[model samples]
Target: MRKIPNNGNLKMTKVAYPMGLFVCLFIYIAYIKWHWASATQAFFSITEAAAGARRGQQAQGPLGTTAHGHKVFYGIMFDAGSTGTRVHVFQFTWQPGETPTLTHETFKALQPGLSAYADDVEKSTPGIQELLDVAKQDIPFDFWKATPLVLKATAGLRLLPGEKAQNLLQKVKEVFKASPFLVGDDCVSIMNGTDEGISAWITVNFLIGSLKTAGSSSVGMLDLGGGSTQITFLPRVQGTLQTSPPGYLTSLQIFNRTYKLYSYSYLGLGLMSARLAILGGVEGKPAEDGKELVSPCLSPSFKGEWEHAEITYRISGQKAAVNLHQLCASRVSEILQNKVHRTEEVKDVDFYAFSYYYDLAANVGFIDAEKGGSLVVGDFEIAAKYVCRTVENQPQSNPFMCMDLTYISLLLQNFGFPENKVLKLTRKIDSVETSWALGAIFHYIDSLNRQKSWAT
Candidate 1:
């Protein structure tokens, strides 16, 4: 090779090419390192935020214990409604003279008509144990079967196919062997949430008052559930009313009346109500391209005859002038009122309340809007404006007071009871629905400690 001397003004092309490539490679590696560092920092920040939240939860517990206590009780509850399943786990301590201290909590979601137990129990445990596992790294405590686990299912579990429902229960037992178990309808759950530890007293007051006023020894309570509704008709005795207004009956006359109430858990009612307008040619939308099934409750009504109409639902841009069946299914009280010829006799019956998981209010809101702006309930084509009044009662006295969650009123009429008192209490109770499970756990544990103290 011959070496050629060049002027300093221009470098050779071959030498410049390699230098450019080297610079490009160095820049690319540096960019990747910067991105990796940013990503790593972001991940740690998220983790720290989560940990800080958990620490805040732990700080809410009894002093010298939340950060150090070993005897922690974990309560887990699931309320499966017509719309969805909700999972909640709360950590607490049962210490003397102090409130059941809440240390940690978490939640998860499941379909409305499904059972929580059908899902894997350990997987469905909301990862509370995982958090505890990490906590054990710093604090000294044995994780080997030390914490008590409480888990229970309600409402939606009862709607599953029998075999499936039982399987779900078995799984719950397998996962949570310790702690007392309680299962029942959503009514009791609503009662607990709304009544705020006063469910028993309120139930007693309503039942006795209703029985006394009706002058019947028997009474029936029909509670609407999401997947299914319940009709509980029992023999109740007419007792004395706590207070009676002038011309208002003071006590139930000596009438030993047998109650014929039904808590008809119609698996179809909730779904049926929505379908009626679209199905059965009632709302006149020309049923979508599929098999249209009328709920059993609406079977007779649809079978009788199809009196077609094309009524437009103004609000939702849904036009349907269908027959009565489509519009009426949404108003259950009317269906019952018209079907039962002995309406006069049942008129005196006191107290009707609807409690379920699905949003009855939202469903009816759509139905009423489809009916050109009103729904007919109990012989009244109540304009949509007044629809919610029936279930929750009209908020006319104070527009701020009506908290009706549904368009229809399932409770009773004319009981001479103080409406304001009942409503105020009901609203106060409604406010606690979300906090019920945790509140129940807290209340139950507190009661146990109090009873133990009295004995000692």
Candidate 2:
């Protein structure tokens, strides 16, 4: 029958105890995911798992137009890669910070990249339209007009001759103009290797919150694209920047801060392009009189047709070779000599390797094929040696495997990474896809903000 007064602290403990436990559990799980996820699914799933209320993804400036009771935005990015063309439709929600957070993304890819249509730009229209339709379906009809659509062609386009590359861009622009979404003349264009590498670095650092803090150490980025490869990282030592050649150092402004980084894109030295070069096949030039090109890198008994930039060449291994790896290493050394700038600082810095680098490491059993993992620089060499030696005895296997692995190993070594150097090979970091597309969107939004601020 008697009522006792409630002890505020005692009662608060009851509520806070469960709440604190929940927060702790959540943080623990997030830490596991951020540090220990093994591999990743296809592009679609990574974006689906993105947490809502992301930082810096807020409404109006760049993400998208708002609707009833919801802050929704959209950005369409098309990656015109060498092997394929991919479209990324990103949706974001307004968050508490100056930046907005990503909620979900729609991704789709088609084979035989844009470069394949260099001779017939019209053929690229259908694929581009299909990708555009994906954006149309994901974004609400009302937001289409306000949504910004952009397409950035990678090494595939850059590797093409100037006029031909322009033709592809013109065709893409025509396609974008016909679309219902927002369009701009500057939307469709080729992305140089340097931008590709730097953008990827931004995506990684931003996702990991490295750039959000002052004086936070940032990881380096290694992107092995189709026709080119890029390496970008913030150097701890100023000497790294001072000793760099012209155009290797890039200055970037992000979150109101300027960062000077060591970045370089090696044109015509991507895995596939390097393969062509190492095989003694000239880019944009077929063998003389339709003759097959023979090289020491391939198995002596093997011969096949190799397709690159829309040209198919008959290729075979040299018959005079003994010790395939040694010969192949010598050839790869020649291909990479004076081609990629070797940096001693990278030997001590952490790196995130992606694209073909991840694929090759995964396929060779160095890391999880889906849930990627860390690998030593020696893993590539080991795989290359084994694959090359294996192909020599069994010449019926895929020929490029040896060359690709060998090239990756040679490329890393050329970058001054020791055999035991550890590199993180990943597909997704913190549920966001690890690609330049995300960074491209961020840059677009920043430019929009800068323009608006300037006008005011």
Q: What are the per-model C-alpha RMSD values against the true structure? A: 22.4, 16.9
In candidate 2, residue 374 scores what lDDT? 97
- Cα miss at 398, model 1 (Å)? 29
What value does the lDDT take at residue 138 in candidate 2?
Answer: 86
Q: After superposition, how far is residue 381 of candidate 2 from its true place, in Å?
A: 1.3
lDDT tens readout by residue for model 1, 1-456: 997776553566767889999999999999999999997656445433433422212222211122334234554454444355555555555453333434566655555333443545445344323333333342212212322233334345544456766665554454334222222222122221112212222232232444334443443333444333333333232332222122222111111223222222333333323234323333324445533434322212222222212222211111232332334334444433432111222333443333421234324442322222212233222323243223122323321111122212322221122222111112112122332345344444444445555899
Per-residue lDDT for 307-343 in model 2, tens only? Answer: 8888899998889787888989888899888877788
Q: Model 1: runs farther than 4 Å from truth?
A: 1-74, 80-83, 91-105, 112-147, 177-225, 228-291, 294-331, 334-407, 410-436, 443-456
TM-score (all chains, Cα) for each model? 0.38, 0.84
Candidate 1 accuracy as TM-score = 0.38
Report the poorest 10 consecutive residues by lDDT, candidate 1. Answer: 421-430
TM-score of 2: 0.84
Winning candidate number (TM-score): 2
